[model samples]
Target: MLGERILLGPGPSLVPPEVTAAMAAPMVGHMDPDLFPVLEETARLLRQVFQTANELTLAVSGTGTAGMEATLLHMVKPGERLVVCSAGFFADRLIEIGGRIGAEVVRVEAAWGRPIDPADLERALGRLGGGRTTVAAVHVETSTGVLHPIADLARVAHAHDAAILVDAVASLGGADLPTDAWDLDACYSGSQKCLSAPPGMAPVTVHTRTRGRFRPATFYLDLEGLWTYWGAPHGYHHTVPVSLVYAMREALRLVAAEGLPARVERHRRMTRALWAGLEAMGLELLVPEPHRSPTITTVRIPAGADDAKVRTRLLREYSIEIAGGLGPLRGQIWRIGLMGYSCQPKWVLALLGALEAVLTAEGVRLPKGDAARAAAARL
Candidate 1:
């Protein structure tokens, strides 16, 4: 049997026991009467976590990328313009998906580890010059561990008369994102990250501004078709995963119980401690202080350290799991995630200790106990 790992990677953070138990409940039919209320309550709780009163809020049957596709497909028609704020790997995904859907995709890029300047977005919108464009951005770039400014970008998109779509796959419940307050037209996230559920459902919330107005090219990912099953008459578009819905609802319930504000603070606090510890151990972080993500941190691997070897040692020796970098950053950095049930001081300290031991064994020089002391001081 495989040992249970301390999931400190980019996604599918540790699931709490309550959510696991909810998934174990007896399965119900997609159109069953008992299932509708659970779906209704789940949508309601999702609205709470998303901090929006949008009536179209609900969980889609796929992962976070599914939500991205749905949002872009509905918001931007074929042959229309989509201004993407590209800074990291996921932002590139927005560009790729937009191109595949037949939209005129424009990219406004920044350094991978930095936030997008609202001025840059304004300029991109200015070049597009009017008619029905959608501005897409990533709230938290999972690849580089940078938190882009969604609220600021939203304001710029609105000023230029364009809709805004946000990829909150890494932020959502873990970070401070006010959907309605920021006037974001569409937003989506995966259940596996900050929501602490299994890796299946994608919780999406679309503002009523464009609700039921446009038909997407995709039949299955259509927002109108989805909301139809999620709300009113309760029609069936696809066979909703009853077990995954149960897990998602229970996870959202836990979010409500802890309160979003408290949960966000916990993520922030834990990340700060982790950062202090990593720096104390003579490590350099990829993203600077201002633009760093609270949920995922990117650390620069020191010279002579083997990225895959270090991560393998952590998993094999300590049963801890972290991730390596992606794309051009591969072999250059490590991605450590602090999210949901896994974002706690104990796990942060455990990782620091284990990482230090691994580095020492690999002939990397570091003073023992410095990481723990620095992290504990913050805690």
Candidate 2:
């Protein structure tokens, strides 16, 4: 059962054997002399994968949610204003975390399955009367499979003298988001999504401009402390997960070897083929083609289909896995991920065939094997 899964769900993408094997090697001390070099190399590779020259790039313990909390709590202190442009579930998550941290949270929301518009953000700040502020947004909303343009949004945030923070949990590594080139102040992403690693580590990058500006609210997630441990002085902040580090390093190596542009292109190519197959089955996409995300695709559940039944059949009958929608979109759409190692022709074709069979089994009438033929034509 070494490679038994077809992990086509929204997250925790299929982990390649290389990454898992790296984790299986002998575990080492967090601060051991021999291990420091591995840590340094990991940091270097992280910067490359993140597409940022920011000096604060490093992986935080826990999942992507931890990355979101650490970033907001660290940058937006108590009593500060955090303007969140919410489009889907993860965007709303930023608001929740910001409010819990004692920041004055203001929301500028878009309908689900759409990207956050920059004009709305400008209006939100204009109403806030614009001082030193923060604008938080989700770069690619995994819940809705929509991609937001970070560079334009960052421009508006800077115009209002605000630091722009983006949640790239679903977009990073698979999508083309140049953190430094786009002028993002900070961004965080999950290891399980596009990185094809385990679900514990969250990689985040911070700008050098905020180097000495503020201290982290939480001690364990303090950016300065984490940097000190990952970098110079090599001080011990806490016990780092050496095995996950190995897995993350191998994953990043895969990202590098495939080349960033080509990796993103592969994800996009698979997305197009998936869309062609789904559309040929008379299924509609939750989001429009222009705003669709390359990493995850959200499909509307047809009139005669039962979401749970279709998904269960896919799992039980085909041994394939896909996710149901989240938050407001729950039970309305199915989230299918084409990410990292899982984005390939074989996986795409397999899911299409499985979906066709399951939808028919669930009594949703459609031509048999149409999806597979359409997908083959595109692929």
Local accuracy of candidate 2 as per-residue lDDT tens digits, 9-117 = 9988999999999999897889888888887888898899889888888999889999999888778988889999888888888999999988889898889998888
User: Mind giving the per-residue lDDT tens digits that candidate 1 earns over 1-379?
Assistant: 9789899999989999999999899878999988999989999999999999999998889999898888888788888998999998999999999999999989999988889999998887887765788899999999999999899999999988889999999998899999999999999999999999999899899888876666778889998899999997799899999999999999999999999999999999999999999999999999989999999999999988999999999999999999999999999999999999999999999999999999999999886779999999998
Give each model a TM-score: 0.99, 0.97
How many steric overlaps are in each model, in order? 0, 0
- Which residue pairs does candidate 2 place in steric collision? none
Query: In order, what lDDT does every prediction score?
Result: 0.92, 0.89
Deviating ranges (above 4 Å) for candidate 2: 1-3
Candidate with top lDDT is 1
Deviation (Å) of 55 in candidate 2: 1.1
Worst 10 residues of 1 by lDDT: 123-132
